[model samples]
Target: MANQTKADRAKIFMPFDAVKGFREALAEKERIIVPKTELSEERKEELDRRLRMIHTGDIITVVYFHDGEYVKLTGMV
Candidate 1:
């Protein structure tokens, strides 16, 4: 028999406010993964430096996953 390991899953409590503005609910909760890009070396360096300067609770814009679409949106700041 092959060895099998149990997978762990995290429960994400997406607040009601997160879905309030959307016309569709289930269509807005999809999986999204974005990789950091290196378009310009100078800009990338600046962003990295600024990221290190930010404090906890500071917000940033990221990709929002929908049922089949990914949208870029701004969150808390």
Candidate 2:
């Protein structure tokens, strides 16, 4: 044991996962699939107006959908 390298000792203490891929499968199943909402004409116009108001060097926040989720981020433009 004393002669074993650090890498060898680390490998000996590594946990054994018997249910490989189970966690990922379970998370996929548990995830809620939300249907994307369609913007109304009035809503679209409002959004367009707000977008045009933004200019360079402005700090803003945006909300958008990605990969089955709605994400919001704030940063400088």
Candidate 3:
């Protein structure tokens, strides 16, 4: 048997995830689907004004409800 230190021996028990889609495939098989959400009339009008106010070369962070959660994403206009 080869002489190995604690760090070297610890690596032997680490998980191997080299296969690209294996984890995603397993997650999809067990994922719970969430219904989509719609904005209210007042909320829609509020968002419209915010959109119009954003001019060229403006950066914005958009917050919306999706998949039973509030997701925030940033992008440049």
lDDT of each: 0.59, 0.90, 0.84
lDDT of 1: 0.59
lDDT of 2 by residue, 1-77 (tens): 88999999999889886899987899889887777878999999999999999999999999998788777899999
Name the better of 2 and 3 by lDDT: 2
Please give the distance, in angstroms, between residue 67's alpha carbon in candidate 1 and its true position after superposition: 12
lDDT of 1 by residue, 29-74 (tens): 5444455443598877987897787776778776645544567886
Number of backbone collisions per candidate: 0, 0, 0
List residue ranges in candidate 2 displaced over 4 A.
Answer: 1-31
Q: Using Cα atoms with residue i matched to residue i, what is each candidate's TM-score against the true structure?
A: 0.32, 0.59, 0.51
Candidate 2 versus the native: TM-score? 0.59
The RMSD (Cα, Å) of candidate 1 is: 13.6
**Best of the candidates, TM-score:** 2
Taking the tens digit of each residue's C-alpha lDDT, what string does model 3 give over 1-77?
A: 37888889999999889997999999777765666668899988999999889988999998877666566899998
Candidate 1 deviant stretches above 4 angstroms:
1-38, 63-70
Better of 2 and 3 by TM-score: 2
lDDT sort, best first: 2, 3, 1
